[model samples]
Target chain A: MKFLHTSDWHLGRQFHNVSLLDDQKVVLNQITAYLQDNKVDAVVIAGDIYDRSVPPTAAIELMNQFVETVCGELGVPIILIPGNHDGAERLGFASKQMKGAGLHILSNFADMVTPVIISSDIGPVAFYGMPYNDPELVRHHFKQSVSSHDDAHKLLCDEIKTHFNAEHKNVLISHCFVDGAIESESERPLSIGGSDRVSHEHFVDFDYVALGHLHQPQKKGEEYIRYSGSLMKYSFSEQHQKKGMTLVEFDEQGFRSATHIDLVAPHQMRIIEGELDTIIEQGKTDPNNEDYLLVRLMDKHAILNPMDKLRAVYPNVLHLEKPGMLIGMEQEMASAKLARSETDMFRDFFLEAQNSELSEEQDKAISDIIKQLSQQ
Target chain B: MKFLHTSDWHLGRQFHNVSLLDDQKVVLNQITAYLQDNKVDAVVIAGDIYDRSVPPTAAIELMNQFVETVCGELGVPIILIPGNHDGAERLGFASKQMKGAGLHILSNFADMVTPVIISSDIGPVAFYGMPYNDPELVRHHFKQSVSSHDDAHKLLCDEIKTHFNAEHKNVLISHCFVDGAIESESERPLSIGGSDRVSHEHFVDFDYVALGHLHQPQKKGEEYIRYSGSLMKYSFSEQHQKKGMTLVEFDEQGFRSATHIDLVAPHQMRIIEGELDTIIEQGKTDPNNEDYLLVRLMDKHAILNPMDKLRAVYPNVLHLEKPGMLIGMEQEMASAKLARSETDMFRDFFLEAQNSELSEEQDKAISDIIKQLSQQ
Candidate 1:
């Protein structure tokens, strides 16, 4: 059985008040075409289907059309789980009824082991859909008298392993930030206020783990756990990284290595520094590269109607940043070059702040501030 | 085919912050029991299954239990449509997939004619589900130049008739306020900041129209258009109305008259007007009724902690209105009684004001105020 792994579509996302509908449509069309061409059996949308819980009508319609086209016209099965960004209950509505069309939606903890059995020539393959976990829900689910970051995840792994069969190939779908996965600039880190993290080792029992939440397509370790990354580069930090989906094949032996399908989206984010007129002239010469254009002007004086001028030459000119970014980049590079021993740096900072005397309370406050800053 | 017609469950509805879950549970349980005893083939929930678009998980669980109990356990086909208050696209998510479990959710105008053919012992009965109509949606659905409220509704009726079969007992379910149905305070009226009503005659084609939106159990004229009413009295204006669901039986000849199963929930909504102390004493005698009490205090002075006193006697006390309601009620009654002709009253009043010899500007201002008051 061949499966297409993708997640964090965020269909109705808005970047700086500009609607991503057009770009999203382009990417979605590409994905649909890819699925049809590749003859993918099942598509796994891990989570974060919509940017917000309360999506607009347009988002809903787009989702409906996509689902209809995939399941109705193309005859592909879809297994979707809800992310932290979605309303689980809303997503799970009429799920029991929708099973006939081969679209499986799992949004609750109770439905973790209820796999959609897909029959292949080898045997029956189980596709498990697990939604994003909240620590509070995890605690309540197990009814365990414990308070720790790893407690819930450990329990979830234990409970999930009970339903697994060593005889058949078990593929688990999840939306979680495992320890040590690379994060994109636009990717929201799972836990900001608390040190809540699930060890990547917990997923070792399953033959394959199709993961979401991390927006950078990368492997974790020697294990079969991987993140498919986001559909498109949502931020500048992801500009240097490759964005795409994963194709996993499974047989009687177990799970096989996945192939990363590179996404050729309309826009390729770029950062350039030059005068407005010069950049415009350069963009005009590259007429075929009209899909994406980023112009950064180096001029000290403001250019009137810069957006209008750039757009006149390139309709897809998405970003415009001043040469101030270059100054910031140079400063960052200089800081990175400077090296100081941790102990010496702290002693020098303390001596400078206290002059001749340093109180215990003041020292403790400084240490606390340093600890907070380091965490950020 | 015997089908039970019901709507406006409003599962998570709270009457002024008072949880109606208990009442809803009782009503829903009774409905399940009625279905079992009567041996109904199908159940039609016209619209407004949930009070809000994004209902809580508890509400979702309750809905799941109900669907599982009615359709999953009993094997009765339960059909649903979205009402004005519901998010149609959200409710309709993966609806086509769920058809295997005999649960149908219709949330779009495009699928209005696509009836579910239920093969009962008698024959194949076509059940059509039409969601609540928005004028804008109606215009878009028909793809024509619709100018007025009547035109929009007429187009929908016309479309429905094109698919309507006279030979079979065609049952139609809708969520719209008909012209002559009794209005209840429990209902959120069609408040588009003005009056825009669909004529009652548009629903004449169907053998039965299981209507919703208006939370009043009633029949307009002698035809088969009926409102099953809300499961519980959501407001004081509905205190006089009986709350229940309608069970209808259809045969080869046509539709048969159905019986309304009266539902008495654990709590009953009451409006009691008295002094705080007296009402508290009354509540003590009937402590069980206190939980469902809607006390309207008419004390001369403001009563501090009146709710605390009332709750001590009646735990289910929902509302505590200050003395102003009594005054307002009296003013309403007095205005109703004073039915003098506006023209005659204005002439006599004007003659008396002329005796005072006010300035022309003042007369004009007074006349304007009088005119506005008369219109009201």
Candidate 2:
């Protein structure tokens, strides 16, 4: 079976107060088109299907439209789990009834016990889903001691291992911050004060482990365990990420190759760093000036509303900063090129401190005090 | 076709800070048992399936069990909508794909145009649904001037009327507060400031108008326009109400009789009034002390730790009150049978105000002041 692996769609997410709805729609269409062109048998979305537990209406509408087209129109089956960002219950509503129709939402501890089995040319492929469950809730439901995310994941995975059928290929889809995975600013911490990580060694028995929660889109210790990353750049800190999904091919023999499929959204998040005038000039000639931008200026002076100036060229500039941002003292520091007299040093220090030069009368008083000190 | 009408399950709801998950499960099982015994063809839940958009896990588990048994197991088709309490977008997720199966959730304005048709012996029964949408969202989606609930409902109903099948029996399932339906305290107002009521005249054309929101389980101006009410008593003010559902029988002849089916939950919310000692004495033999109780004391004295004492008898007593709850002054009023001396009245007032009697010096001062006032 050829499966499209994706996670952290974070639908209804915003980029610096700008709605990513249109951008998300454009990229989702790309994924759908790929599914059609590539003949992908199924789609595996690990988790973080929505940006929030109670997603915005537009987000819900977008998800509704996407599922209707993919699962209903395209005839491709989808297996999804709810991430920490999701309300598991709401996400899994009518999941059992919808399972036969190709949309399988495996959410909750009970879902872990039963796998959603799918047929392939080789025979059958069993997909086990472990949706995100907090430690306290896990303890209550599993009737075991769960003080950390590791305890929660280990206990669930251990029990699931006993239910695995040896005849078929087992694939585990989960939404968790695996130990030693790269972190990103966009991801909300699963636990506030405690550790929110689980070891990947627990899933070594599975043929393939598709993961989410960290938006960097990297692999764990092994090649089979990987994160497909987020749909787009949700934070400026993730400006360098190659936002995309993964494609996994497997058969009766077990896991095969996992290929990376790059998805370029309508707009890219980029950082433009240079002198104010130079960057503005670059923006005028740049074809994709509409990209979401964070500008860093190298100029020394305090430019009057540089954001406004930058925005005039690049309309999507979200933030701006210069070297000496605190007191605007870069210009004064540059002027101090030689060893100076006490009066000159004192004058420069006074101007920098109080934003004003001393009057002639004050200067005379300072000179008199200096002369007295020198004689003594 | 025989239909079981119910709404406002309010799963995961709490009563006076106590979780009613068990109570809700008991009542929902009652509904399911009714479906099995009566052999109803279809189930129509107008709205408020959950107390909150994101319900508790146990509530979700209960609802999941209910739908799985009712729709997946028993093969009874269920039609539900989102009420004011529900997050429409979340509640209606994958509604389109799930429609082919027994469960049909119509939770948006577009659903108003397309009715979920169920087969009957004579012909088809078209069930048009208008889920609760805020007037602002209605204005945005419908692109019309809808500033009130009246406007919102009328516009949707008007649009739905155009698509009604003349060959079939038409039933309109909605979650709106009709103008004259008596409301219960537990029903959250659809709108806070402005009117949250729609005119029942808009729904007159439908053969049977099944509604939710007013938890009284009563009819509008006409008997055909009925509310199935909630699954259980959600508020103390609804103590006198007979909590139940409606049963509608329809065919080619259009609407028939709408019968009220009384559903007795395990616990009934009731108010017990009398002296504390008398009620306690009665509680010794009152087989159903587990019923949620609100005690209204007729005793004149301030009993020490009345709630603790009351809970010993009626273990579920939620509130305690007396006629003179504010001042604890009923005892003084009761002792006013004789014309007491001025000193006695002053002494009593002083004792009540300070919680202590006048000392020798204070009594002498008060007597001297009264003597001077009398002389004046």
Candidate number with greatest DockQ: 2
DockQ per model, Cα: 0.41, 0.42
Return the interface RMSD of model 1. 1.9
Task: Please state the CAPRI-style docking class of candidate 2.
Answer: acceptable
Give the distance in Å from residue B26's predicted Cα in candidate 2 to where it truly belongs: 1.4
lDDT of 1 by residue, A294-341 (tens): 667776655678889888877766777767556666777777757654
As a whole number from 0 to 100, the lDDT of residue A66 in candidate 2 is 85
Off by over 4 Å in 2: A15-19, A133-167, A177-181, A188-206, A251-254, A300-303, A321-323, A326-376, B134-155, B190-204, B325-376
- Candidate 1 is graded, for docking, as acceptable
TM-score of chain A of each: 0.81, 0.87
How far in Å is the alpha carbon of A182 misplaced in model 2? 3.8
In the predicted model 1, the residue pairs found to clash are: A97-B97, A97-B98, A98-B97, A98-B98, A274-A298, B290-B314, B291-B316
The DockQ assigned to candidate 2 is 0.42
